[model samples]
Target chain A: MDLEDTLLMMPGPVPVAPRVLRAMSKPMINHRGAEFSAMYDDCCEILADVFQTKNDIFIISGSGSAGMEAAVGCTVGKDDVVVTLENGKFGERFKKIADRYGKVNPLENEWGYSFDLAEVEKKLEEGAKAVTLVHNETSAGIQNPAKEIGKLAKKHDALFIMDGVTTLGGDDVKVDEWGVDIAIVGSQKCLAAPPGLSMVSVSERAFEAMDEKGELPYYLDLKAYKKSGDKSQTPYTPAVPLFFGLQEALHIVKEEGMPARINRHATCAEAVRAAVAAMGIEMLPQLDEFSQYSNTVSAMKAPEGVTGNDIKKDMLARGITIAGGQDRLSGKIFRIGSMGNVQPKDIMLTIQELEVVLKKRGVISGLGAGVEAASEVLDSLL
Target chain B: MDLEDTLLMMPGPVPVAPRVLRAMSKPMINHRGAEFSAMYDDCCEILADVFQTKNDIFIISGSGSAGMEAAVGCTVGKDDVVVTLENGKFGERFKKIADRYGKVNPLENEWGYSFDLAEVEKKLEEGAKAVTLVHNETSAGIQNPAKEIGKLAKKHDALFIMDGVTTLGGDDVKVDEWGVDIAIVGSQKCLAAPPGLSMVSVSERAFEAMDEKGELPYYLDLKAYKKSGDKSQTPYTPAVPLFFGLQEALHIVKEEGMPARINRHATCAEAVRAAVAAMGIEMLPQLDEFSQYSNTVSAMKAPEGVTGNDIKKDMLARGITIAGGQDRLSGKIFRIGSMGNVQPKDIMLTIQELEVVLKKRGVISGLGAGVEAASEVLDSLL
Candidate 1:
């Protein structure tokens, strides 16, 4: 199969812009050279702007998970008490990382639910030094209240760390204003760059904490990374070409103003959610007040006699790639992403494809109903 | 400056093959898709063949350092004893990583010297559970006695780990025969792919150790990665485009037989070394027996009155890029790479450019001397 021609409707590894792809095709350059340093400087500056932080930002040549590890390792040392808000898979991953190094107080919530700030505040009152949360839970299509959680963390004098993997470019993440001590972003999610590079912004409080406790390991040590970034270089050999692509991707993000980018994702989410609702499917997270527009990769109830895997397999046959729920929801829900470079037409086509796939699998679906519903929503927005 | 036109003569982040660049330009795909799984499976099989092992191979969406951390985290636990042969910057990095989770017995050597296998044996005999060494130390232009050290580790019952970052595709590495329980490779160096993905192979013995002590942290945990790779996927989102490029690059490596590829690198190395010698310059590592012909890079001494930085800057002015020595030898030596898809013409042009740069910087007698020397060597062989 020609994967290049197939449309990626998944949450991440989203469709990259042609310009970004062309930019990445440029030949590699010396990472320490003047030209590359200029590129690196520009990337750091623009990434800080995107993250809305004046604190030092370091680019790690790893995935979002690596960024999480770096965040956990650099901030909380061995035997530290960490309170993790686990509303979804990504949040639980933070607890897993914390469990590796120290004691973890997992503030568990339902899979399709988000954390209540009051509950988190209660956990923080129990003497936790750090609190971790995810901005967007890709697994469950839920967006947590990070700003509220940050406030709670501040009230308790705990370090607030956020995994902004799927939310950075498509959402507003004011690290300083939100009192986030460490904010991590992956290149592939909303930035429309291929995944490899991860950016983290560390607050002065976190830096001081790292200085106080010097037990952190070498590679993930935030102090060493910060020192190296002062020279526009990483402590190790970075993924140079990916850095180039990121520079171009960040440029595109800036060109499309941040508010407009977020609105675009919101529009896409609204169109998808409206169509799914019109098709008589229930949204997993029923709390509209807590619903975020960063793009809802909504989980729908499978039709009679049809499984989520059945719909996913049929969608794949029709040249569309959607995601199935992970962990407990794996066989129950289907996920379609409307973030990054995805256009209204892409969404419309996806809905149409979904209708066909559902019908082909002998599930109950009206012919052309999904497309009509999505188009009506798009027309009203346009 | 047009980075695309400038030849990459540096040790890594080298110019990728046109085919590899084109492959990377392919559109992003869902990491969980069957097509992606197929590509991942193919790449892993080719990587295992290249390492000459029957062990399971994994490709992480990160740089060489990420692979190194995974290797260290997987093999050694907290308070485990690890002996590292520190000869250059990368070896020091190994010591740093070892110090993170375990006690390290560092057998330190000079910056430009190869490790003494007898000394490594002595250290391992002093109760180290594992021995870490760089197969080819790029910073010093030295290839350690991996075969001898592997035998020593077997006699001492220590897990043998080698960093094959710069040597995997350009040189012969028999992982099983060399008693290397774990071997790591990066995409940019000799694999001819862009820098992002790192590959690691684990022997059955390493797997057994991991099975016994399965408490590694997430992200760098081998057990998590191994479980995911059983279905041909990573535990987290991967850099999809880079994997596409790596799949193509691995196919090219297999198309050209491993021995033939190693011989090609040897031929290029001999020609580069001959040209440098004729210019009355010394190589960093003087012992010929310890020399490795992974033409990926060759370290040479700076001429009298001309620092390695001076030569590198001059080359950059002429749109060529040769790397200066890293860490302690930063201004003392330079390195030239002729591996990957670099052809004879590229070597000849680099030689011509080097002669001009050297003469312009007042380091050599004649402008055409180095080119003539290189051409004579090529004529003798070809």
Candidate 2:
């Protein structure tokens, strides 16, 4: 299929808005100039709103992992003990990054499952300088107990850092209310901006901890970021075009308002689940009370006779790009995104196309069943 | 001035080509997909060619400073001795970065002046794990003694890491032949791509040394980049639109050919010197035999009565942008870029505009003198 007409249905690197893409095409300006300073301040202010935090926020020029790296490396010293929670790919990444800077006490659960908070509290009680969690695990389509973990971390006087990569812009993630010291989000996910920039909000408590820390990585030094950020500058030259795109995307988010945006995402995700259930597809994430199905993406196990890759190929050939499961779950599950600007109509189109692919593979009992079920859900809420 | 009418003549964040800007507006593609793999592979291949090396090259998803951090942190262990040469802002940055990862033996020089090579050699002799130098000091507009320093580094069994940010694409920098173990370049400078990405060329020797190192910065991990580069992927999601812009910029460089590009940059820089000399302006840098005036940027002392910022403001008022001196040299000198797609015509227009600004400020005794002298150089070479 040609790129001009394709629809990206993946959880991340989601379809960018036309104006956002246009913003990226603008000519370069001196990043240290007044124009850049105004733009940088505006973008960071909007990001603080999205994170729902009064804490200091800074933008990292690299991807989401750079944000994660800055959050951990700047605050956790070699002598510090970090309690890392892992259930899926992105969570595992947090653990790996924490392992680099501090002694790690990893608390892991099966992918798509909830963590044992009792065990997490035990680890925190034993002694921890910080606790890290991925709020929304895009890999397994599950939302972790960030609030519960943050409570436990606060109770034990440990810094709480959360990876809100796929959750921040699409859902109501209150960084200050939940007692998160550092919260991170990737630009390309729920923000609908191009991939390349990540934003992190750092609390005063975290800044104090970082001030006591020594010899942080020069590039990901949050203190340097904070110092420059006060003047609306970066420690180094930033990716100018990406900043332009992110600013435009944030403007759109502001115009839509967070409450409406969060409601839309939740409605879209519920519609997808209804459609998949009607198609007799089992949802991939077996989330418990503290956990929930991901609002940004929906993951489901492939039917008995259908291969995930085969379905993906059929959909791609038909001009829709979706993702198959990653790592050990490859070819066993399929995922579709409902993040960013994606709404009820897009979800209906995606489910309708999925029905066509399944029908071609003799795995569908009824052609219109999934779409009809999705339509009912969309009609009831959106 | 409005953005559309403005022309950037600064050393970095130079004016981008129309085609390169267009490339950045393309829709998102899955970074893990085959299409991105193909694009990533092609970009790295072209980068190696521009670097004039067969060494392993990887793109870092940050600015030039991030590339510098990666080059220094990955290879220099905590106990290693790093001989850092600082003559300007960027050189000082290299020293600071090295200090975080290793014990730094700093050799300082005045701004706009070359380092004392004999002193540098003494440090290497005393024992250095690596020798750090900025090939082109963009801030001071001086090219350091990279070739001679590299020779000493090789003789002393120290890794030679050079910041070629302002020189690589627009000059003949033979990374392999010069005995450079790691060479770094930023995309926004001579590459004429949007800032946000940096490329580094690592020799086999540097990789061998890195293999023995521990606890490198997680985000700037060269080993992670190398592992993902083999599969034409990044360790994390890259800035996709910037990659597209860089690929297009590289394509333009390849079409012009490096030799031709280098000649053009040299001629443009020489033409600026000729033009400024005709106006009785003094060059900023005090070059020794081993050191040279920069070919990608020209630094000139502000006329006795004219402050650097006044010239910059006057130029900006006329829809052209130039840079004033930074740090201690602020308001003392101004710099103009001759990098990337800045041709003789752009240089001619810039000087013509400069004459008007000076005449308006009562600083010009003979208007158009700079333009006429620049025309002669352009006519003779290009």
Candidate 3:
């Protein structure tokens, strides 16, 4: 049960970098003190670099979903028209959030499918004030066409917001280039930190939207948070130690170089997909053109007569923690993540273990078949 | 900069218990996994015992303020009247949160003072749907009469919500006996865990109100959370590691026994207060009849020539971190907290350090004077 004894292979709450863990264990400081302010300023500055924006960056002391709530709460008003592209669980969640505040125009897609830019553009042309999409859908292991969607939002004068919970550090999320007005990321995903702090970068347009909205419930109000950040503090006491951990994680990301890191993730993801395909299991989204290269995770349909839960349970007994499909696809699809400091060797080990578990659970697959395919993929990349 | 090398003396993010730290450092598990569900269920059960309630208990993966928002969001609808008792900074925050949703009727009191029940009763009599108050106003080191306020809310047939951020584990909060409908506690405060998760126990009556008002924004909607808890999960992914840590911290609390823990806090608070009185520095809330005995923090005025910030800076330089006055009382008062595994030895060490620092800053009339007074107080307790 101890963290030191286990290797987490789940999409998030992945193994934190040792440096980040050490940073989190540092002495607690007063959030309003000058020392903490200095750290806070440096943290935000580096975060802006990671986010690729000049927009204000604020850290909410909560999970990724809290960041989503803050984004929707700050932008959408009682009667606002919000278009949310739903490709997976998290995207559907954005629609639910929009439903809470305003009218939701869902650009719905099947689970394990990517959004069609043309259809989304049609929805935007029909009059939506804002559009929300998930950059990477961890649940279905699909990455939507965020850049195209962002361009479409601009075409119709709609604010573009994206949930980058599982893709921020591992994928190419150039907020400025993508024309994303708001982008949200969490610490526990590709950041390789624990699951507590959520980072949000907001552009000028989102700030103006907040300005036009007079009353927001205090805790989630972007304006109040922005004003407080001017003094390098949160309006309320924050999760101070979590930021210490994040500072170290961001440092690691910077030192590694973002593009190289993203490429590494892409490589790892390709290896995972190659192994899964070798097992004769189909990738959830069959179109190679629509495949996302984020190293975080790969989704595959549970082969006929095999449920995702059965694979998950079998993997668990072998100390591997793969995720089952979420929402509508639960029990039908299986997901394997290789992001967050996971190297090729780790992925190979996982594939080896997975093959063993599958065979032990009565699958007649050859043990080395998956590993050989994954090795070929790795060799090709090298 | 290393955690083990430093002492955390601020009220919250106070030094986490070693056991809790180890627990938090454990490997991450799927939030919906059987192992995590077991931990979650145990934590909730223990939390209910700590709050003295059989009602449903849930944890939000955010800071205490997020819990405050949840309480306010779930119980009140648009245009509902919420009466807040404002004596210090936290009380004012309650007013701000209530104002975000609907009408907020604030029964204002001077800073560094306790609530006047007579005034609260008057406001409640005027037809409010809910009343909010901070059980422990850490800013001013004043604890309000939660039991009395709970009576008023019940009399008016209104939901009674109390913020026990700094009070819950250190003080006696009899939720059932006090008729408190909604009570919130944070992990970092008296619970001796890091700041990430917040625990809330809702009464059947509060659920009734939420059921009647279905307009709550998604994340903060307690009804959605309540429904999810039935499955031993959250509507959104949770901070699983923090929740694991909380389970460990709550276990320690249960093993120690609630009354014993409360008495320990009381004893520590009394020793600190007695020493402060002997130093000839005035306590902020001077009325003996209105004083509360929560063990977490003690608030007092700065001596004639010494500003609170100066005293705090001096303490910080000596490796102690007593807080300066907040809000309106800034630079006029200081606070010292004694809760969560802090002992008399810590109190004595702090007093000795404070005496030296005070004399060095020329703020005290005599050298070793404050230490001697604190020693005498400790001797009397023994």
Candidate 4:
């Protein structure tokens, strides 16, 4: 019940800002009224700034996955070939959704690794309708090569669909510059807003692709959203309260400024990495050539004698909610999120708390070293 | 900014209960955590009571249309024959959605009329994969003969899908007795919650049908929902705040008791009907053999020399929100809603406000006739 006292350090549904929470509590307004239209317009404008795109943005009243489905459902029809890069759970999700509507050639990669650009280009050489990529794979704490993949999509004359779910607001995401034909951002991630809404930006090329594909599933149809969005409306009733929260969240983001926000995320993530390394913990990616560790989330391997669930449970007992590895890697790795409304103080506290858990479990000897290293990072940032 | 002062009497995004607003302000929780699971279980139990079924209830993150799409997308496959009943704008929307997934045989009726059961049965007799019906069409203020349609669907061995967007909680809905295979309800409508989440009840028969149909679009996939729901999870992140609001709204409904709740809605609607009739206004359906007026919303014809938009503008000036006709009926009819957190007093006040607008426009002579009629119904109800 004391939701604010507990720190949500999971990949999403992160600790929301006080302003956003208050915004969500505001009385409901008529969805088709002028007031809602003004709010909608203002939110879209602010979202464009956050997404770093001039393209039209459509806010779906569902989760990030719904936006993912819409991106594919509207463009890829039966028998259409779509090249999907799968490196983590979310990447596999894109493939699964695309498979439902079209023929998908999945360029699979290891969960904790990034895609090989050469192999991805080879897959694209087959000439597909679109190329789908997840910029930040929350499951593996990896950021895929979206910019490179976008280039491949362009070379192959394929529409580039990017899932910026974890990285959009917390990091530098230039959709237009990256040649991302369609980009989707989840509200709960780095946006520091409550979950339930997904904002998508569409390029003219993607619009043309959908037009050629004809009509899509009624609810996921992009054409309907575009038509209604011109009038500051959605084809169906939207989650109005979420929109209010998102607007306030965006205002907070503006106040902090994007450059500073991205830098803060980088600093916090680096501090977490430094502290984990100081505690003699192994990160999941192991500092490979790709170095895909996400600034939004840090996925690290469990200590030799302990499981990730043990760390998660221990953290939860201390009022900090850390995530365990999912899917095939369940109980193998633990993840700490540094996205959204998370501050340096929270990360410093989390690192210190993690040290206590590790030392009590007899996994690490240097109890205070982790906290000290993280503190140094925090102090330098200050 | 003064949202509370402006009465939102639109069919949806209806005025939310105070308790529901407070619930939305609750701090965010991990969507996949134990605490969330407990909340999820509680919400499902409450929703089962509201839907009047022993079937599984799904809380989708999107609006009502997304629920409608899931109901159809999961059951009907491509090239299959689907019988759709269309008597209003929402009915037409159902038809449009079904048409994308299957071959639709639309049984069209007049906008302000209920479906002719015989015609629907005849269409179903043609042997369809599914039959889609809107229990209450909010646009034309019509509640179709869902029980009869459900029976027809069963007789024809077709899946019965019903859109209870506007009627579920405000009116008596017996899902099991009525043989509704899949029923979708919006949180913002009769549920008296904020607009965002949609609750859907699915029967075993519908699930078996979907399994036979193979995979559906990823986000709307019912199987994923069922799988995740078993563990008290959603396939994707949900709107946590909205879920809190819905749970609180359901709790409030339980406190009020169902019989009393249904009676309250009926009494308030009757008051509005009596008041409008006294004001010499023609209700859209004209109270003939097939009365289209809904207990939640009443649609009426615009008076001579006054468009529905004119009335809506006038109402807005007086700090009330009413809906004008949509699509083809635009500017012809106006609708006043008495659903969600609305009470007899709100309806009476709306009628009195309408009388002022009508008198100012020379549409009615007796100024207090409408208010007096409404007050009489309110007194009788009390």
Candidate 5:
């Protein structure tokens, strides 16, 4: 099937903006030439502004997982003790990558739960070289306490590495203020670009830590990336078309302004939550005393009458795409993303259609109630 | 520094077809959905036809180096002996990547030189776990002895891995016949698709060999790719739009027919060499006893009076983007790529322009001679 009439609302591979899509049609150029070098440097500057950091930014020609691999593989050397927080699938993935190159002290928590600061601090006190944390766990729709964890790791003299895959651009991420030594984001997330590239911002401290270690995997090695970044080049040929899309997407981010973009995501997320709650549905990782709800993608618990798969299937049939829970959470929760250029009108339509599906599945008794509630939230925002 | 009205004659990141460029502007879709799965499977079938193999094909979401890493990292275990043939930059890169995971016995040869079969057989006879060879060395414009080297590795019971980055689509590559266990090709080369994704074909024997080893890195792991290939998926999110372009590019390849495509590349190479020879310029490698010229890119030695950099600067100033030599070849020679959608007319214009530039630089006595020679070669092909 072609990609003509479908609406992509998954956590990633999000629906790209029209202009950004058009940007990918640009002609190819020499990757090592001045034209590409200029584009590369422009992307780094734009991404720096978006990440709210003065740190060094590298554009890697891989998905978000490759960026995560770089964060783990480059800084954590062999036999080095590293602390990793695993509260969701991506968190566990960080631990897995770190385990490949170093001694990992995995601090496991419940899937829908956020990290416990006390536990993290205690683990850090055991003298780890680096700490890996997920800023926003998309699976559970929880924004973990990266700020506190970053501070703890800083005090412990450990480099703070973060997976900002789903939250960096759609939400507020203060890389420098949060004491994050390394932060990674994907092209298709809140940036509204096509997938294939990952933007990584590395702090000076992180570079120093990496320099102390031996070379990591060739393609995933951040040191090689840094060496090439000094001249606005990558060690290998990058995805040229994706770079064009990302540059245009970053320009759009600048035009809308990061603050307004983050606010829009927050408003859309609130409308979604209000609409879903009106249908008597529960959200996963129901906000606790510590963790906050994710403002990019909302994860809802499947109703008692049907599985998450059923709702996803019905949505797909209607030309809309939402995501079912991953791994153990599969069939338990469905996620609706509000990241990137998802407008209020799109959210209203999604909620309306979601309500129709819920009623068709005999989960909700009333129709239009979810839409009405969402419209109220939308009206307040306007 | 805009990408418009400029010629790209580099080894890769070559000029793309309009249809392939437009295809990249298609809207995004769910990566895990049936639509993407179908597109992925279709791409694999088409790529298998291009690779001339019935082996399992996996589409990776990184550059060609990632595919190379997957080939080396998956099959070569720790302490395993991996014999790598180094004749150019990419060959040296393979050695570096293999050295990361296994015991590498590098058979270093001069750049622009083909592998000595006696030397390769001698190394393979020493009982290695794998042997890495580049099918076409782009940096030196030499097509190496991959077929003979592959047989040597097979005879020694060693897995044969090859870097087919620059030759897969533009030249004839028989993976099974050449005894290549794992072959890698990039999207931006002869496929006429933009860079970002790399396609890999793995033999059953390579799969068995990889199974005997431990897990490779997550993103570059071929096992995960194989598992996902069963359902036409990737372990991580792929570059969605790039895949769209690749599918269309593969369709173009089918329409043109592989034999015609290979012949077109060969004719273009012959015309380039004939034209340069008429202009009194020498080519790199100069035809060794066993090695042949590459059909995709032509490497020309700098004339007596100027360096490769001078020629590159003059061409760039004229809005014609040719490439200077890479690494050690820098300022020593220049490259002219005839791969992808670059047509006979483009080559004709490039040769004509080259003569003008040479005459203006006082490196040649007359104009139009190069184009005259190229036209003769083109007419002979017709």
Candidate 6:
């Protein structure tokens, strides 16, 4: 039964709907044929709506990291300087990818900390060809200041690349308005599709600059994807079944409409935060006035006398799977993913389980308090 | 219905089984968890049997071309001189990939033509670091002399990389015995899984040489994959559903036994060839004594009156899809895939369909001739 028997509450790859899964069971077709072309074209059209971009978008058979690599490796030249802003793991990954192709000026910050826009502008002033930011830092449960940073990148004429792996479909990300030349999103994240596909949207400026860098690595080359995407075909053989799942997922999003889905994600995140607060637990991310909490994942500090792993195991025993801290934050914090297909009932069940775990250890005031708080938050949204 | 209504007879993306498709519909779980680890381990073990090697295998998210790029890009340094052997589109692709990471000395041959080992040996003697050969060029339906070229590479102390995208499962490929340092395979080809994942097997020599070349591209990096794969995890988020499909496909392969499956592929190819010969059509590849035909796909020259496209259209109209020759050979030759779950009935149906299409154009004497020849071939195999 796998995750079907348990409630999957981790960020990205949250529970997938049965409709989407069934779509994947369809027989394989000619990727170069007319049927696939039409299906692919529909996927792109619906994706444009979710991405909220007039720019051209291409789907590739790879991870979100592959999409991140394509964004930096295809545009930045060896002699070019890139400004890599880091506050979380994915942001650090951008620096890693950029360092391979260009000279990097990093604005490194502690995990869960916000970036200094003025300092970031200084790096762009040094004439960087490109700058990267993870719009939603899932690792830290914080959303970076993309709008402010994009303004700086625009003022300096630096190409702005945003990794919206967890924010694109569930949050308000105006790719065009934020001046994002390239926006990358993973299928398993807010899109609620299977992992393994990355969708990248490119602006006119980014498209033109890619050619100047000469040929990119053969597989992740975006131009080739564009040429094939125009005909509703992939330049290389695609994972056809995953594309079917993603298209079905996107169609669900289209039916619900972006605004409604985005609001639902916000409501779910707020409910989780409310339940945690009612239980007297503090959040991990130290958010500023300009910076904000992530609307897709919640990172909470582990209560006194217990580690995050303790709470995680306790929940797992009760048939709920939440995430513990990664890397340096391990055992210090716990995470509950509020992205993709997650509903009010999922949040209620998660909160209820957390209450049971914490009550046994006498961390919470009593049973039903957290759920009541979460219900109030859900009721307010309604 | 997509390819469900029709009999898909194209090379590479051969028809996937319903059981394999259903496996992909399973729910996604934590990739780092114990469940995924066990499943991934099984996939690797089963895949090793298909590859017929003791070397370590890694499943990466990308196309067969991506696997080809990984084998070449990860080992060859920027200053290294490598020899690339080319005879078809995919062979030319290996040369293109090798050119990006190292200095390439390519031995170019016409499509469907065999390589001259003496000339290849001369190039290897020029102190090349690595040599690449496409074990099976699906574009031309030709299987190159991998054993002979590998012997030459061994004498010259050059790392031998083989693109076995279409041959590993269907045809006998003695990777270790052939002295191949690296071997690549695609999921959608003989494996009959979805097309989005590429599994690559690496030898100790290739593994040790990868570090000397420094860090490769971020996503395509094998060292990282090896580290995580040791724990039944991926370095990045993998296509989980595809992994499920591949595991199911491998389980089926294991149940049938690799030796039996390999024999079936050969018999299918032989049956198709016999039927085509009965119709008096010439095969595309001019196989010499050392060189042999591809057991995964059969490419035959179009008859004088009808072009390859005409034949392809007729097949499609009759709900049987075959491939027209690609690139330069377009409209001149047609390909029928004999890989994956192609059974005796599938072969009989394909030949029967071709007979009806060609008989109308007065190319074949009668309809029963082709099926009769194919039946005889299939009966001999039984």
What level of docking quality does candidate 1 show?
Answer: medium
Q: Cα lDDT for residue A133, model 1?
A: 90
User: For all candidates, what are the clash counts?
Assistant: 0, 0, 2, 0, 0, 0
Give model 4's docking category.
Answer: high
Strongest candidate by DockQ: 2
The CA lDDT at B370 in model 6 is 84
Q: List runs of model 6 lying over 4 Å from the truth.
A: A1-3, B1-3
As for lDDT, the candidate ahead, 3 or 4, is 4
The Cα error of candidate 4 at residue B220, in Å, is 0.8
Counting only residues 3 or more apart in sequence or on different chains, how many pairs clash (N, Cα, C under 3 Å) in candidate 4? 0
Reference-based TM-score, model 5: 0.97
In model 2 chain A, the worst 10-residue window by lDDT is A1-10
Docking class for candidate 3? medium
The global Cα lDDT (0 to 1) of model 5 is: 0.89
Put down candidate 1 lDDT per residue, A101-128, tens digits, no spaces.
7789889988768566677788899988
Candidate 2 DockQ category? high
DockQ of 4: 0.84
B312-347, model 1: which lDDT tens digit per residue? 888878888888988789899999987776667788
The C-alpha stretches of model 4 lying farther than 4 A from their native spots are A1-4, A286-291, B1-3, B286-292
Off by over 4 Å in 1: A1-3, A288-296, A359-365, A368-372, B1-3, B288-295, B367-369, B380-382
The chain B TM-scores of all candidates, as shown, are: 0.96, 0.98, 0.95, 0.97, 0.97, 0.98
Question: Can you write out model 6's per-residue Cα lDDT over B261-378, one digit (the tens) per residue?
Answer: 8899988998999999999999999877768888889999999989999999999999988999999999999999999988899899999999999998789878888899999989
> Judged by DockQ cut-offs, is candidate 6 incorrect, acceptable, medium or high?
high
Error of 2 at A221 (Å): 1.2
Encode model 5's per-residue lDDT on B253-303: one tens digit a residue. 989989999999888988999999999898887455667999999999999
